[model samples]
Target chain A: SQQGEEDPQALSIQEGENATMNCSYKTSINNLQWYRQNSGRGLVHLILIRSNEREKHSGRLRVTLDTSKKSSSLLITASRAADTASYFCATERERGTSYGKLTFGQGTILTVHP
Target chain B: DVKVTQSSRYLVKRTGEKVFLECVQDMDHENMFWYRQDPGLGLRLIYFSYDVKMKEKGDIPEGYSVSREKKERFSLILESASTNQTSMYLCASSPHTGGKNIQYFGAGTRLSVL
Candidate 1:
């Protein structure tokens, strides 16, 4: 079973716009990571935020985690056509024996029009 | 740079046949995982290995089994391939660093069961 669920199953935007996607998980996690997948390819690790941290940034990607609310959000500022892809949030559980194993969310499909 | 490679980019097999998906990583990571991605179901973990010759079952591991004979190689096996088993299989490796659990994925293998 998946631990997280992303909102806005699909999003469409124009170039130079901002794209934001949200993910919510049910269990406590040691860290939450975001991934990007191009069409017909594997997933690329974007960023990882630990439970002790709240927000992280990498290039144009900004991720905020709210442990109290058990949710996280990914923000892509000044999005481009190349940024169009599927975004997924994976949670690393805190209590399980599979410490490093990840449970991914349903993902959000973002399409950026040029 | 870390590189995870899959044995096949696309494969077609008849139903009831045995299937094998191979993954190799060059980063000497301690963790390797197998996941299957579908249209609406997102990515679900099939199995994971923390070390050589050690395996653990994931949420959906009924018909799937994993083999990790070496540190850098992990393989997922399907006992009886079915039409419903047709999906994109992704392999990932992650380093067991301190509080960092980011996974690097291979370019997925698209399997079609006829």
Candidate 2:
């Protein structure tokens, strides 16, 4: 079974609209990180929010983590066509081996229209 | 900046043939990981290594093996390719400094086993 699962298998929105994606995990985690993948390319690290942090902001992106609910949400403000990509949420368990392996969610595909 | 490079962007191999995927990281990271991505199934970890000459099995390592003879490189091998193994393979590297465990990824290899 997967440790993390994202909501909304797919989403589509116009440019300048805000996009929101949600992720839920099954267990306690040390931190949760979000990544973005352009079509047919490697994933790029977007933002990370530790378990202790409730919310974080970077540029036009906002991430909120609610450990009590074991869920997290990512918000992209004023979205652009370049932001069209697949978004994934990964979780690192509270206790793990030294390697710090992460369990990834199925992902959310967001398409921004011009 | 960290750069994780995959040897091939696309590959094709026949069933029963040996297949190898190579990944190299330029940041001297101590951790390396291999994962396969499929539609709706997400990215499942295949193997990970924390150091040279060390390896560990991940969620789905049944048909894959990894080698880490050097700190900068990691390789995933399929002893005998199978058509079911056709998917996008990704390689990632992360440092073990402060538990942040942010990973850098390589342009995935889309392997088609026929």
Candidate 3:
């Protein structure tokens, strides 16, 4: 079973609008990372936020982690058509025997319109 | 920039055929992973390696196996490819540092079993 799940399986918005995707996980994690995948391509690492960190930012991407809620959100500010992709949240479990293995969510497909 | 390269962008094979999907990372990352992506199911990890000659099974490892004879190369093998194994296969690599496991991914191989 997948450890994480993302809400609003699909999201569409105008180019300048901000896109927000949420992810909820089942267990305690050492860290959570977000990745973006363009159509039919490999995923790209966007940002990573550790369990101890509440929020992080990189360029126009903002990520927030709430351990109490076992959830995380990725926000793309001032989105562009180039940002259209599937966004996935992956969790690195704190107690898993498999080191460096990540459990990924179902992912939210984001479509940015021009 | 980190570059994780896969052997093929697309592949088509028959059921009961042995198949190999190769991945190489130029960054010399310590950890490498293999995952399959499907519609509505997200990405499922198949196998991973932390070092040369070391391998670990991930969540969905039943139909797949991996080899890491060299530090920079990881190969996913399907002993007998089944129709159910048709999906997008991705390879990723990451460095072991700072409690961070941000993975860099390859463009993926879209495999079809006929």
Candidate 4:
């Protein structure tokens, strides 16, 4: 069973709008990281939020994590056509076992129409 | 700049043929992983290596094997390719930083088994 699962599998929004994607995991994790992938390309690291942290921001990206609910959300503001891509959330399990291993989510496909 | 490179962008192989997908990282990362991406299934980890000559089976490793003869290289092998094995294979490497081990991914190889 996959540990991380993203919601709103597909999203479409016009350029300059905002897009939000959510992810939920089944187990405890040390940290949650987000990544983006352009069409047919590799994934690019985005932002990471530690279990102790509730929210983080990088440029126009904002990530919020709720350990209580085992869920996280990513917000992309002022979206551009170039921002269209597949977004994935990966969780690194709590330490002690499975060190350096991450479980990835199914991902959300975001389309920023110009 | 961290870079993880996959040997091919696309590959085609016949059923029952031996197949190998190669990945190399320039960041001197200590951890390398192999995953296959399928639509709606997300990225499923097949194998990961924490050190040279060390390997661990991931969530889905039944049809694949891996080799990590060197710190900079990790190889995913399909002993006998099958149609069901076709997928977009992604290789990733992360430094053993002991904190926030963010993974850098390759562009991926789209393999088609006929």
Candidate 5:
């Protein structure tokens, strides 16, 4: 399992502040993804950055991938109270067979206070 | 809108009992996955199916089995439930478009074994 480790197991911030989380994995990957879970229910895919790509943005989310370091960072700018949730980083390795599987890191619990 | 739906929001089962969890997707995705999320442990894949009647074990597939009879439906079975099996189960689906694998997740099912 190419399980990754996430830095800062927990984070707290006020509304309108920016939040950033970082992830480090052990193996080479095809892509890395960030996901947000609200109340530990459904997970919504926030953004994805491929190995060849340096940075990618979706809405208020910015994801940067550094394959040379086997790490990635997710930045959420101008966060809202609704953005308070657990964030996870997942790695998609190059599959030899039929595989769209992802290995996730221990998530970072973020609290955005209003 | 693409959607993945799990059968139950919460479930309670006794130890040694057989348990089944069902998942369905509407996007006609080729890849479907079942994962268990534990506190501080992140999401661990139990099983995934890329096509009908084809299944692959994920990182932690112990005591868990899966079935993909149709394209849109996937089922997870625990032959014998245990106290340690109490956790949040998440189902996800991803389309096979070129080399891109963007996953869509379902509202998870919280299962508790007593």
Candidate 6:
């Protein structure tokens, strides 16, 4: 319902398991980015996928964007305890008077059990 | 590597007091942003500056102001800190180049307004 809304507010999984989260936005966007935030720390940039692109891979992270559906998904493969953190999806709206504005979604909190 | 730094890790203030949160980046980024993070609310942009001495309000700019007098530093000011203002404040910077312009964030400042 929000501009950028992520599903599965919290996730708990065993180490080595894959974690997947979904994000949906309302309006058209130029690109979508994923960020990870450890507890009590700043957010770390993960990956970015442009609207025209459907999938992107970075290290153990894989992100997918579906512009026609206005949705995106982030998949963390072989999760570790160190990967336990909150993940957020941000949307960079298409160019206009308010271009370059990055709006974040309510993040998905991932907990990796050691 | 791009690095963004906040002046404080934790700050305690009383209601109605003026508070200043400082952020500096070593990356010489062209755009800087200040955001407040709250549980379930995600990161709400307070203000952003594209260039020195130029600022634009973000989605939630009320009760907060920003200053960008230099290329690497941006400051967020709360004229009258309120209990509702007790949240994690984050600062980020990005080069406004033609690329993805992924943002680098500082370790947030946690402000508790009593």
lDDT of each: 0.94, 0.95, 0.93, 0.94, 0.90, 0.92
Instruction: Write model 4 residue lDDT over A8-108, tens digit each, in one string.
Output: 99999999999999999999899999999998988899999999999999999999999999999999999999999999999998868665788999999
Candidate 6 lDDT by residue in tens digits, A1-114: 347999999999999999999999999988899999999999998999988899999999999998989999999999999999999999888877443668999999999999
What is the lDDT, from 0 to 100, of the residue A14 in candidate 6?
100
Residue by residue across A40-62, what tens digits does model 2's lDDT show? 99999999999999999999999
Q: Compute each candidate's TM-score over C-alphas.
A: 0.97, 0.98, 0.97, 0.98, 0.97, 0.97
- lDDT per residue for candidate 3 within B1-114, as digits (tens), equals 999999999999999999999999999899999999999999999998998999988888998888999999999999999999999999999888746788999999999999
Best by DockQ: 2
Model 6, span B1-114: residue lDDT tens = 888999999999999999999999998788899999999899999999988999998889999998888899999999999999999999999887664768899999999999
For candidate 1, what is the TM-score? 0.97
Superposed by TM-score, candidate 6 places the C-alpha of residue B87 at a distance from the truth, in angstroms, of 0.6
Q: Candidate 5 on B1-114: residue-level lDDT in tens?
A: 899999999999999999999999999999999999988788999999999999998889999999999999999999999999999999999988655588899999999999
Runs of candidate 1 with Cα error greater than 4 angstroms are none
Lowest lDDT 10-mer window, candidate 3 chain A?
A93-102
Which tens-of-lDDT digit does each residue in A14-82 have in candidate 1? Answer: 999999999999999889999999999999999999999999999999999999999999999999999
Residue A108 CA error for candidate 3 (Å)?
Answer: 0.7
- Score candidate 5 by DockQ: 0.75
Clashes of each: 0, 0, 0, 0, 0, 0
Which has the better TM-score: candidate 1, or candidate 3?
1
Q: Which tens-of-lDDT digit does each residue in B1-114 have in candidate 4?
A: 999999999999999999999999998899999999999999999999999999999989998999999999999999999999999999999988775889999999999999
Q: What is the lDDT of residue B28 in candidate 6?
A: 78
CA lDDT for candidate 5: 0.90
Fraction of native Cα contacts reproduced by each candidate = 0.80, 0.74, 0.78, 0.72, 0.66, 0.68
Model 6's DockQ score: 0.67
10 residues in a row with least lDDT, candidate 6 chain B: B94-103
Q: Give stretches of model 2 more than 4 Å off.
A: none
Model 5: per-residue Cα lDDT over A1-114, one tens digit each: 536899889999999999999999998788888988999588898887888899998889988989889999999999999989999999888666536778899999999999
**Lowest summed-lDDT stretch of 10 residues in model 4 chain B?**
B94-103
Which candidate order results from sorting by DockQ in descending order? 2, 1, 3, 4, 5, 6
Residue B49 of model 1, lDDT score? 92
Expressed between 0 and 1, the share of native interface contacts present in candidate 2 is: 0.74
What stretches of model 5 exceed 4 Å from their correct place? none
